[model samples]
Target: MPKVFGFAGYSGVGKTTLIEQLIPRLIHSGVRVSVIKHAHHDFDIDRPGKDSYRHREAGAHEVLITANRRWVLMHELNGEPEPSLEAQIQRLSPCDLVIVEGFKRSDIPKIEIWREANGKPMLYPEDKNIVAVACDVEIDCDGLPWLPLNNPDRIAQFILNTFVHD
Candidate 1:
């Protein structure tokens, strides 16, 4: 099984930015990484009038678009219950690690991204699965492992040491 870790935080926090930085650094270090980001609202990769969009709109449950560079498979739930995180992870191709963004309530090891300016309470206090935190400002962590939000390399190293390496 691929090692899984997550980043969870309130909106306006720099979770995406941190992940973006970590991906390149991990890749450069020769680690195979894949990311799964959760969308809180409706999102569409296909544009209007495109054949894939038209097919989906016409009630196709799944659409596959293949090109020279890549391929995308879009599956429509059509009111079905959203798939569980475990189920979603099972569908991914093999990799060394899977970095999940969001799904805050899931029972997976996670690093909570925090920004004091967001005025949000710390999630680590409430979620036992939260193993560490990354923040822009030094805040009381209640003894949780902490990393600087500005240093993606160090953050990446922390992740690799904690989860990817034995």
Candidate 2:
């Protein structure tokens, strides 16, 4: 099975930024990576007036747009409960690793991204699945792995060393 890792943090703590930086490094290193990001608010990938958008607006349960280079499958819940993380992961194509952002309550191993200026309490103390922390300032983590938030290359290397194996 492909290895799975996650990043969890309160809003504006640079979780997305870290992931953005890590992707290129991982790709450059020849590691195939996939990401699953959870959005709390409603988001739309298809814009209004587009065929796919019209199809979905017309009550299509799912709409798939295909092209030579890429394809996207949009599933409409229509009040259905969101699928579990495991179910979502099963939908992805094979890859070297799956990096999940958010889904903090899930049991998968995660690295918590923290920023003191975010004015939010740390999540690692409460979430046992968190295996490491990337932060802007030094923290008293009781020996948990600490990664510098400013250095994406180091962070990428750490992730590769910890999760990816030849």
Candidate 3:
């Protein structure tokens, strides 16, 4: 399995945007990256009119949709308990790293994304898994390293350095 790192933050703090910026940088650095994002609400990648959607709505437990360039696999829990992070990791093809978004309380090493304007309390105070803070403004990280949120290159390098040592 790939090494796992995570991004944890409250809603609308740019967790998704930071991950978007970081993925390409990591890929450029030659680290194969996969992402597992936890959604707190019901969500779907397929629509009602699509064939894959029809298959799923008809009681299929899994449906894989493919085109020439890419493919995606959608699985229905169908009342099964949600799997743990490790179980989800096992489903991904081997890569150098897996950048998980959400699962804020998971034990994996994570960078807590923060924005001062968001008016949210810092998570590092409670989440020991948070290894660093990525924020729009400098703040006390309680001795954990403070990372500049705007510099994807620096953040990407930190991730690389941390990954190698771990």
TM-scores vs. true structure, each candidate: 0.97, 0.95, 0.96
Over the stretch 18-91, how does candidate 1's per-residue lDDT look in tens digits?
Answer: 99999999888888999999998999889999999999999999999999999999999999999999999999
Model 1 spans with C-alpha error above 4 angstroms = none
Residue 84 displacement (Å), model 1: 0.4
Clashing pairs in 1: none
| Among all candidates shown, the one with the greatest lDDT | 1
lDDT of 3 by residue, 64-165 (tens): 888999999999999999999999999999899999999999999999999999998999999888999999998888899999999888999999899743
- Segments of candidate 2 deviating more than 4 angstroms: none
Please give the range of 10 consecutive residues that has the lowest summed lDDT in model 1.
Answer: 137-146
Query: Candidate 1: how many backbone clashes?
Result: 0
Question: Each candidate: what lDDT?
Answer: 0.93, 0.91, 0.91
91-150, model 2: which lDDT tens digit per residue? 999999999998988899899999988988998888888888999997878779998899
